[model samples]
Target chain A: MSFIEKLKNAWVSNNSLLCIGLDPDTEKFPDLFKTMAKPEAVFAFNKAIIDATHDLVCAYKPQIAYFSAEAAETSLEQTIAYIKTQYPHIPVILDAKRGDIGSTAQKYAAEAFERYQADAVTVNPYLGLDSITPFTAYRERGTILLCRTSNSGAADLQDLSVDGIPLYQKVAITARDHWNSHNNCLLVVGATWPEQMAAIRQLVGDMPFLVPGVGAQGGDVNAMVKAGKTADGNGLIISSSRAVLYASNGDDFAQAARAVALSLRQQINVARA
Target chain B: MSFIEKLKNAWVSNNSLLCIGLDPDTEKFPDLFKTMAKPEAVFAFNKAIIDATHDLVCAYKPQIAYFSAEAAETSLEQTIAYIKTQYPHIPVILDAKRGDIGSTAQKYAAEAFERYQADAVTVNPYLGLDSITPFTAYRERGTILLCRTSNSGAADLQDLSVDGIPLYQKVAITARDHWNSHNNCLLVVGATWPEQMAAIRQLVGDMPFLVPGVGAQGGDVNAMVKAGKTADGNGLIISSSRAVLYASNGDDFAQAARAVALSLRQQINVARA
Candidate 1:
């Protein structure tokens, strides 16, 4: 099934738009995990969180840096495999943000889809169409492009005006008009910028957005949903990483994570109405 | 020692600006490597290339995609360890091109410097300074920022005019004035666009450029050197991967690679003079 279909199915089945970001920082782990190796601790924590909150999330987003930082790619592989096998309806988005020249990009595409088996992958659009095409060529998988990022410095380049339009809008237009030939393209319009998200929504027309920055980053959940939601109120995959993952640093961590995920999902559904 | 000092030392010791990119594609491996596992094959090939041409180049760059795609991170780790161990003077630049929000960027920084032990790492500038600060925080390690990439579609966003100056020039200006406080910052100015390279050189005076696209991507050596060379003729690290790597798909592959590296180094020197 195509990534969009998987997303839609997941959204309907789970009645949630919350994408739990599995960014395991071992330093932030609970006391019980202090003795285990970093990778094992990450995997154990993620499994518990998944088992507790699978039905409350539409997708699972795993940031590659956390695993790779500790040389924990094996745990990452196992994490995705477990998600795919146990929560088969939920799509897995690999937040890699990879961008390179054509030949190198093809290898990254293979890395994201073939090696990691992610249903969708986030990529940087700095290298333009040829770099994006390699990922989009996997017509069934989703290729999420960065438009207006959530960071304070995103304005350093993204907000630069080209002619009369801003650069991020240009990125949005290009991704919408040119790069989405396979209908597998999406944009990362950070919830931190609600107004920009609205503008991007207008430019892309129902192309689902992977909206990050809503939790620990302090992006307003209601404002983002109101600004970025499509007619069906299901166009945004609002992601929360640290806020939910580290809700409690004790043995109740999984329960705390599930509680946060449930509250976010409910808040989102309320905003949808 | 700082990465810039390491780079300069290697440049003087080797009397060359050429950097060999160890992007090991198993499909392109010579017949002798076909029977081995992908990771082993990649490590063996990279070891041969490093052994053959270590004396002929300023630095060695191992593109992470080639290893990560095949779940060969072990080989990549081993390759960098081997370079640092056997050839202590030569700097290893990890061409990762990573960029993200501040929190996640920290993890990526750790991945590159701590896990892989890369002397320097390439990063994307689209996310701005805060995203870059985590990498630059390692005041001793080099943080190479992407300015004008060598890809055909680089102009898509890079050429956009911001207040009459191009975006790439703005990037060059930012990297020079703001990001170089520790003197560990470098710019990636592609050899393909010599005019742009010259312009960037004018913007960021004498800041060393990690120049890619010389051999395999059809960038002219003399044109790039003329455009990008500093007053000392030593501000560029010109990289070539495929041309020197797969120079001959036979048992004499290592010999062929060394020959190509020698020739390219000679050409760059002639251009420098």
Candidate 2:
């Protein structure tokens, strides 16, 4: 099945649209795991989180940097393998906002989709269409391009006006026009920007969106659902990281995470209906 | 010493400002290596090329995609390790062209700099200061921001004017202002556009540049040097991939590659003088 179809099926089967982000902040982990080992501790923590929340989430978005920071290629490989083996239905969106020239982007596409085995991957579209074309070449996989981001500094470029239209709007339209040629394109609109989300949805029609910035980043889930959801209510992949995964520091961390995921999922379902 | 100092020293020591790109295109390899094995043949070819051209060039940029297209993290790790062990003095720039929001970008910074042990990395500045900040945080490492590129379609967005200044110039100015705080930022200006290179240099001052498009991309090295050279004649690192590494298809490919590197280096030196 296509990545989008698989993702929708996963959302329906799991009864959740919550994408648990595996940031794996070293300082947040308990002191016990800190001293255990380098990449082992990271993998163990990730595996436990995945096992606990597998049934509650439609997808798992592993922020590549956390594993990369440790220079732990082994842990990264093992994490992907574990996800593919344990939760075959769950989509994995490798949150790597990579964008480069054509020839170079081909390698990044291979690294994220082929090596990591991610069902979907995040990309930066600043270099224009050619930079993003390589990722969409994997027609079966999903390519999530950054549009209106949730950060405070997003206005620096994304909010700039280009010929009376905001740059984000242009990016959304251009991505829809150019990237759709490959038939696997999605936009990343931060949950924090509900108004922009509504506007972008109006412009791009039914393209799937990877809506980040919900949990610890203080984005309102209700507003995001209301503004960002497609006409069919299947286009939004609401992602939360710290609020769900690191909900509690105690031994019941996994259970606490599941509880948060369930609540978010239920909330999304109600909003959709 | 800082990365910039190290780069300057390498340029002087090698007597060649040329930065040979080790992009091992599988199709360009000799017929003998094609029958040998999968990644092993690629690795063998890369090792041979690096051994021959190590002294002829100041830096080696391995376009991560060539090895990454194999979809194997082991190959990526092995390739980086080989460069570090075999050519220790020649700085290795992993041309990943990664950029994202501040929080996410911190992880990429750790990945490219800490994981791959790359001396320098290429980044996209479309996300503004947040995207580029994380890389500059590594005060010791060099961060090359994308300016005007050598590609045909780069003009789509990069040529668009933002309040009288072209997008690439604005990127350069912003990178110069924000990246100066860390003091380890450079620009990626294609050798194909010498006029843009001259204009960008005026905006960013004496910062070093990684100039691509010199080989098969039809960029004139002499024009690039004349336009891109700093007052001290140490600002440009002219890079050529296909022309140098694939100069021959026979067993003597390494020697043939070395001769090309030497020629490019000589041209750069004479042009600068």
Candidate 3:
């Protein structure tokens, strides 16, 4: 199935928009996993979190840096496989944010899909069409482009006025008009900026948005749901990484993560209603 | 020492501007290392190429996607260590093109510097200063920004006129004024578009340009040398990946790569003089 269909189906079936980010920092791991190697410990913690909270999220976004920096490809590979086999319905979005020339980009696509088998991947749009065309060629996969990012420096270039509108809006227009031939293209509009999210949602009506910044980033959950949702009230994937994954550093960590995920999902549904 | 200093000192000592890219693809590997595992074979191939051509280049840029995609972190780690231990002076630019939030960006910097030990790393400026600040904070390292990339789709968002100035030029202005506090900043301008290369060169005066698109991408080498050269006549890192790495499909691949590197460097010197 195409990524959008998988996303929408999973969204309705789970009744949740929460996307817990599985970004593990070795330095921050609890004392229990120090017995094993760093990468293995990271994967073990992720597995525990997934087993506890898989039912509460439409997707899981794993920032590749956490694994790549440590040469933890085994853990990354195992994590994606485990998700696919165990939670079959939930999509795994590999947040690599890759952008390169055409030939090199083809290799990146192969890496994300063929090696890791992620259902979706996040990419940077700075290099333009050809850089993204390779990723979009994977018709069954979702290519989420960065629009208004959930960072303080996003204002650096994304807000620059191009023509009468801002660059992020231009990115939205381009995605809407030119890209998305296979109906698998999506966008990342940060939850930190609800007013801007409303403008973006209005621009790309009914399209799904992978919204970060709802939990640890301190973005208001209600404001995000109100402004970021599509017409059918089900077009948002709210992601929370640090706030959920590191909710509790002790043995109750998994339970604490589940509680946070459940709370975020329930609040999102209430706002949707 | 700072990356720029290393890059300049190496360029002057070698009297060359060529930067060989060590982006290995297993399927494209010569028949010799095919017996080993993919990662090992890729590393062997890179080691051979580096051994043959280490003296004729200013920098060695290994696009991290190829290695990361293959889970060949061993090869990547070994390659960087080999260059530092063997060549010592010539810097390695880990062309990851990474861009993200502040916290995540910090992890990526660790991956590039701490894990891979790359003296310089490429970054995407799309997320603006905040995403780049962490990487630049490694004042001892080089933080090369993507201004006008060596890709066709670079025109997608980069060429859009932002208040009479194209987005790429605006990027040039920002990199010049805001981003380069430690004198370790550089820009990647495609060798394909000599006119744009010239335009970008004028804006960022004397700042080195990591020029890709010279060989297999069909960009003119002489034109790139003339337009991309800094005022000191030695600031262009002319990169050619596929052209040099896959120069031959036989055991003579290393010799052929050395030949290509030598020719490119001589051609660049002629253009500079």
On DockQ, the leading prediction is 1
Q: Tell me the tens digit of each residue's lDDT in model 2 across B185-269.
A: 9999998989999999998889999998998888988898999999988788889999988899998899999898888888888
**Chain B alone, TM-score of each model?**
0.99, 0.96, 0.98
| Pairs that collide, model 3 | none
Candidate 2 clash total? 1
Model 1, range B176-211, lDDT digits (tens) per residue?
888788889999989998999999988888889999
Kindly provide the TM-score of model 3 when superposed on the true structure, using C-alpha atoms: 0.98
Scored against the true structure, residue A8 in model 3 reaches a CA lDDT of 86
Model 2 lDDT per residue over A1-273, tens place: 789988989878987778888888867775657777878888888888898889888888988777767756577778888998978888889888877778888878888887888888898887777888889989999999999888876887778777777778888998888767977999999999889999999998988889889888988888889898877777888899888878887778778888888888888888877
Candidate with top TM-score is: 1
Q: In model 2, what is the error at residue A212, expressed in angstroms?
A: 1.3
Winner on DockQ between 1 and 2 is: 1
| Ten contiguous residues minimizing lDDT sum, candidate 1 chain B | B174-183
lDDT of 2: 0.83
TM-score of 1: 0.99
* DockQ of each model vs. true complex: 0.87, 0.54, 0.85
Q: Taking the tens digit of each residue's C-alpha lDDT, what string does model 3 give over B115-223? A: 8889989999999988999999999999999988877788899999997999999999999999888778899888888999889888888898888888898888788
Worst 10 residues of 1 chain A by lDDT: A37-46
